[model samples]
Target chain A: MLGALKRLWHKLGSPRWFFALTSFWVSLFGWAALLFLLVGVVWGLAFAPADYQQGNSFRIMYVHVPAAMLAQSLYIGMGVAGFIGLVWRMKLTDVFIAASLPLGMAVTALALFSGSVWGRPTWGSWWEWDGRTVSTLVLFFLYVGIYALREAIAEMQLRARASALLAMVGTVNIPIIKYSVEWWNTLHQPASFGLTQKPAMPSEMWLPLLVMVLGFYALAGCVVLTRMRAEILHREGSARWVGEWVAGRRGS
Target chain B: MYFDSFTEFLQMGKHGLYVWLAYGSTALVLLWTWLSAQQSLASVTRRVEQQAQLAARNTQLAARNTMSGGAATGSEREQNLAGYDESET
Candidate 1:
């Protein structure tokens, strides 16, 4: 089994294969995200009934929840990439981690901003210092630090190593951000709209949320894939074939 | 099925601005981020190619300079040899 697994890993680890395979997956996820998002937005915004207490304002959940979920997952992903980059000295892994930064920041910002917006309507305030909110805020800062750290270093290899280290260190916030509500008596609601358990909502409420979640995932995937491809091109520019490939692509 | 009329939906039962702003800003910012990345990638790619082109051109120029110097050296030697021959005669 280990041998078989090693063979599979070797095949998948090829840059050519990874690029080709990622294109396929990105397209699939991109389209699926689009379809799911469309259904989610229309259903959540137009079709679903308003909440008894929150009214139409509750529809913001479709955006807020998805962004929050994406933000959480993207950070974990970057951390994993950082680990791979540090362990294997894989250029692609570092590139992937770097490429993911902007998207992750966007999602984190969206989650925080939307949460603030949602807060004002529901809690009569636009900001809170609760554990959940505060920890997620720190996650956003960690992302910024990684981006800034990478940009500050002049040497590319050193930059990647340093930023990856920072990312690996910052990953402790993921679990804390996730369980902040359960860990403390925060104002934020506990996880009811989870993936595994049944959502504490009617079909109308849950279905749109599902769509939005998938859509957000699609958007993130598309963004990151594009970034990764560009990073590959940038890094490969010195290769003999890269110049010809660039010329061909440019001509086309 | 949700709202009785457009007014109620717009009203958001009193949270219209907050709700719309939150969702709208999220969507807009996402669009901006994607567009900006594409721009950055384009610029970076262009810069790398330009640097490569500049390096190749510099090598060509250096070769030309070296060739010119060699020919000039030969010309100076010939000129000096011609003066010596004339003076000896």
Candidate 2:
């Protein structure tokens, strides 16, 4: 098992292998995301019971919670990828970082936008400088900053190293974002899902939420893989295998 | 199904605007992300294909130039130069 795992790890280091392996995964995940999102959205929006206190407005949680969770998770994943790229200098790790940044930025923006919209009805204000809100905003800025840092550098190695370092450093904000609501008085509520406790809401409500969260993950996976494949082609354009691959694609 | 009618479903208990706005914006963002990824992939594929074609063309041109340079005799070279001079005139 260990030997197999090691072999797989080595294989993952090769861009061509990674690209070929994930080609089918992109579409698989795309279809899964579409199905899951459709089911989750329809169920959450029309079938699930509305909140007694907040009413149907609570349905916004379907999109809001998933986006918020995915935003943080993507950042953490990027940080881990950065660490791997710095330590092992695996080319695919940097590809992952570069490919995931824009998606992370978009998801973070979605979370912030959804949160603010949800807030207007619940908190009676669209914007607040509270702990959770501010920390999440900082997370958004961190994505922008890393992306800008990458764009500003022309040398490939320097750009990868700088962006990896920044990604690793930016992880500090994640924990703060996660704990912000608990650490300070804020308009935002506590997390809906936790490992140690049952959800405060009924199964009917949380079930569709679970589906939406999983669907969001699938969506992220699909987009990131597609982008990573593109990045690999961009970086490996001169490689003989890349040329062959393009020729093969043209032939087929 | 939760509401008596589609209108109530849209209304969302007087918070229709907020609920729809959140979902609408989220949908738009998700759509944009997917479309941009597909676009970038297509663009990169086109670029890589173009680079490959350019490289092949360059190699072919280089090979042809080298062959012509080596195979041409002095007379043939002079004849080509004379042809070029006549075209210039």
Candidate 3:
């Protein structure tokens, strides 16, 4: 099983094969993302019971929590992909990094913006230099730095190597962002949902939140795949197979 | 469904502005991200197609010039080469 998994991993190094494989999966997940987001948003916004403490304002959790989770996860993903790309010189891995940056940046901004918006009423302030908020803000800057680094370097190989190294080093922030609430006192609340323990909120509330989390992930996936497909085509456009593929697409 | 009517739902029991702003801004940002990415992809793809067509035309022109064996003029060939250089830049 390990060898089979390794073989599959190696096979994915081929851009043509990877692009073909992702096309079908992208479509499948695209629909799933739409359904999950629609159901989760509707359920959480309307049907779920109001928060006794925060009242209806708590509904923001459905969007905010999921966006925050996605931001963190996407950063870690960039770290892993950067590691692979740097070590193995896998071009596809760089493609993953390039495709993820814009999405990650947008989502991180969403998390911060929404978090502060949630904070305004609860904490009576929009901005706080607390552990979680500060670390997350740092995470956002790291993304900006990665993109800027990529743009500054003209050579593809040097750009890839530099950005990948930066991504690997920047991963130190992910842990800080994750543990910030526990590590220090912060206006930001500790995670209410966890895998090892029962959720703090009631099932109705948490359940929709669960759906929203999955939906946001799927949505992120769809966005990445869509962008990745374009990146792949642009990078591989000169190849003979790409010409055939483009011609075929045009013909169809 | 939780609210008595659409008005109360919109009102969100005094927290309406905060909740709506959060969700609304998030939606707008997400939509903006998707649209911008899609637009970038479409523009890049179109550029790639145009570049490919230009390259093909260049190759065809070169082939035709070679086959005709000096039938094509020097000025025309230079102009074609110049176009190639412009495309590269």
Candidate 4:
């Protein structure tokens, strides 16, 4: 099984094959994203019961939780891709890193923004130096740092290698960000929702949140796949298959 | 449906501004990201197509130049040199 998975991974390293393989998954998740996000947001905003303690402000959870979760998960993804790129020397892994950086940064920024917004109504303040918030802020900057590293280098391969290295080094912070809330006293509540165990919130509330989380992941995947496709085409522009692919697009 | 009326729904009890602002900003950012990704892909496609066409044209021109020596027909040279512009990459 391990050997088979390795073979599949190597096969997927080919730019043309990767592009073709991801096309169907991209479209599938694209539609699923639309369906799940629409349903989840509408349901959470309207149908779910409001929080007894925090009232309607808790509605922010539908977006905040998912964005925060995706922020960390995407960072971890970048780290893993970086390791693969550095170790296996997979060019596809570099493409994955480039494609994910912008999306990850956007989601992280959104998480911070939503968290701050949620803070105002509930905590009566807009900002705090709590461990969770500060660590996440650092995570956001780490993403920015990687992006800046990419732009500062002129050569493509060098830029990718440098950024990939930075991504790997930054993996150390993910755990700190994840555990900050529990390790320190903060106004931010613990995760009330979990997939592996019983949820702290009632079914109706956590259910929509669960949908929103899945929707966010699906949406993130679609965006990354779209960007990765473009990166693959650009990098493999000299390949005959790419020329044919471009010609096909022109015909379509 | 949880609320009594549309106004209350829009208001979101007392936290409407916070709720709407959070959702609105996130939606706007995500939409912009998606649109820009599509635009980036389109731009890359356009660039790749242009480069491929230019390369093919250059190859064709080079071949034609080699086929015809310095002593060439007026019409052929004129045709060959007519508005011929290409970036040497």
Candidate 5:
């Protein structure tokens, strides 16, 4: 099993293979995001019914839910990259870690800020010291620290190893952030938007939420793909392929 | 189907500000990420090509100078110098 897994990793981890995969993902996600965003925004904003409880305030769920989900996914992704880079010593894995940092940070910041925005009207306060909120805030800071640490280092290998260590340590907070609401008596409500739990709100509410979620994932992919390609060029700048590709682009 | 009109639905009982802003920011962030990535790629490529071209130029110039100057004759010079030594049998 381990041998097969190793073979698969080696095959997939190659630059050409990885680049091909990213290209497919970027194209698919880009188109999917556009389609979903259009349908979601048009249907949701224009056709969905307003919530009885929160009135118009509930509409914020469209953006709020997706951002929050992406935030969680991004942290896990960073941790995964860090693990792969540290374990396999794949330069591409390190590239992924470096590239993923900004995207993860962006998502984290969006989640934290949007949650604050939503909390203002719903909870009647702009800030809360609840477990979930605090943990998520820490998650954002983790991303920031990784970002800064990567830039602070001069050597690429040293930077990758160092950031991977930080990423491993910080990943411990992810589950803590997710379960904080359940584990502690927090002011924030439990998960409203997930696979298992049905949305407490109406279909009109959830349909748009679904659209937004799909759109957000697509958008995240596009962002990641773009960054990954750039990272490829940066790391492999001296490589024959990168030189040829960049020359083609410049010539065109 | 449930909505009377699409425009009316989007209004969300006048909570459009928050919804639109949220959505807008998502779009913005995605764009920013893509553009930034492209920018870095361009710079990296440029730097690498510059270094490669410089190295190639240096190697070519060195080769030309060596060819024009001819090969080193250190061994031949040493043999000649040995023969001239007065004490050598």
Candidate 6:
């Protein structure tokens, strides 16, 4: 098993292998995302029970919670990819970091936007300086910062190194973002989902939410894989395999 | 199904605006993310195709020049060299 795992790890380091392995994943995740999002949205919006206190404003949770969760999760994924790149000096990991940054930034922006929109009706404010909100904002900045840092460095090796270092270092804020609500008295409520405990909401409400979360993950997968493929092509354009791939694409 | 009628569902217990806004913007963002990635992929694919074509052209030019005992025109050689430099970047 260890030998197999090591072999897989080595295979993953090759951009051509990664690209070929994930070609089908892009379409698979795209279809899954569409199906899951459709079901989850319809269920959450029209079928799920409304909150007694918040009424249908609670429907916003379907989009808000998933985006918020995915935003943080993507950042953490980037940090891990960055660590792998820095440690293994794997080219694929750097490509992953580059590919994921824009998606992560977009998702974080969506999370903040959706949250504030949800906030207006529920909290009677469009914006707040609370701990959870501020920390999440900082997370958004971290994505932007790393992206800019990568672009500003023209030397490819230096660019990857700098962005990887920044991504790994920025992971410190993730814990703070996770625990900010508990650590400080804040307007933001505690997390809705947890692994070890039952959800505070009933099954009827959380089930659609579960679907939406999965849908968001599928969407992320679709986007990241597509972007990664593009990054791989761009970085490995000189490779003989890349030329063959381009020829094949043209023939097809 | 939760509401009595279509109108009531659209009204969304008078919180329709916020709920729809949130969902609408989320949809837009998600759409943009997917579309932009597709765009990036298409753009990169085009670039790689162009690079491949240029490389092939350069290789053909080099081979022809070599077969001709380096009798290729200086201007033609310079153009081929320039293409090679462009493809290198």
- Identify the leading candidate in terms of DockQ: 6
Kindly list the per-residue Cα lDDT of model 2 for residues A1-252, writing each as its tens digit. Answer: 999999999999999999999999999999999999999999999999999989888999999999999999999999999999999999998899999999999999999999999889898999999898899999999999999999999999999999999999999999999899889987889987887999999999999999999899999999999999999998887799998898898899
Ranking by DockQ: 6, 4, 2, 3, 1, 5
Model 3, B1-89: lDDT tens digits are 78889999999888999999998988898778778767877877786676677777778887898898865688877867777786565
- Computed on alpha carbons, the lDDT of every model, listed in order, comes to 0.79, 0.90, 0.87, 0.88, 0.75, 0.91
Give per-residue CA lDDT, model 4, range B66-86, as digits (tens).
Answer: 787544467755644542443
Model 6 achieves a DockQ score of 0.85
Q: State the lDDT at B25 in candidate 2.
A: 93
**Global Cα lDDT for candidate 4:** 0.88
Model 4, residue A56: what's the lDDT? 95
What's the candidate order when arranged by decreasing lDDT? Answer: 6, 2, 4, 3, 1, 5
Give a tens-digit lDDT track for model 6, residues B1-89: 89999999989988988888988998899999999999999998988898989888877887998998966798987887788787666
Q: What tier of docking accuracy does candidate 6 attain?
A: high
> Which segments of candidate 1 are over 4 A away from where they belong?
A1-17, A20-27, A250-252, B45-89
Q: How many residue pairs clash in model 6?
A: 0
Residue A75, model 1: lDDT of: 88
Model 2: what is its DockQ?
0.70
Candidates 1 and 2, the one with greater lDDT: 2
Say which prediction, candidate 3 or candidate 5, comes out ahead on lDDT: 3
Candidate 2 per-residue lDDT, tens place, B1-89, comes to 78899989889899999999988898899999999999999998987777777666656655766977765566655655564454332
Candidate 5 lDDT tens digits, B1-89: 54577785556456556666666776687667767766776666566666555545545655765887964366744544453352122
Q: What share of the true interface contacts does each candidate keep?
A: 0.57, 0.88, 0.66, 0.78, 0.49, 0.94
Best by lDDT: 6
Clashing pairs in 6: none
Candidate 4 backbone collisions, by pair: none
Model 4 chain A lowest lDDT segment of ten: A186-195
Off by over 4 Å in 6: B66-70, B73-89
For residues A170-236, write the lDDT of model 4, one tens digit per residue.
Answer: 9999988878879988777887876688998789999899899999999998899999999998888
lDDT of 5 by residue, A1-252 (tens): 999999887976777567656867877887898899789877765667766777766666677678778887877887888888888887777777777788788877777777777777778888899898899889889989998998899987899899988988888998998899899998988877677877777676788889888988887787777677777766665677665664666689
Q: What is the lDDT of residue A58 in candidate 6?
A: 90
Scored against the true structure, residue A250 in model 1 reaches a CA lDDT of 64
TM-score order of candidates, top first: 6, 3, 4, 2, 1, 5
Candidate 6 yields a Cα-based lDDT of: 0.91
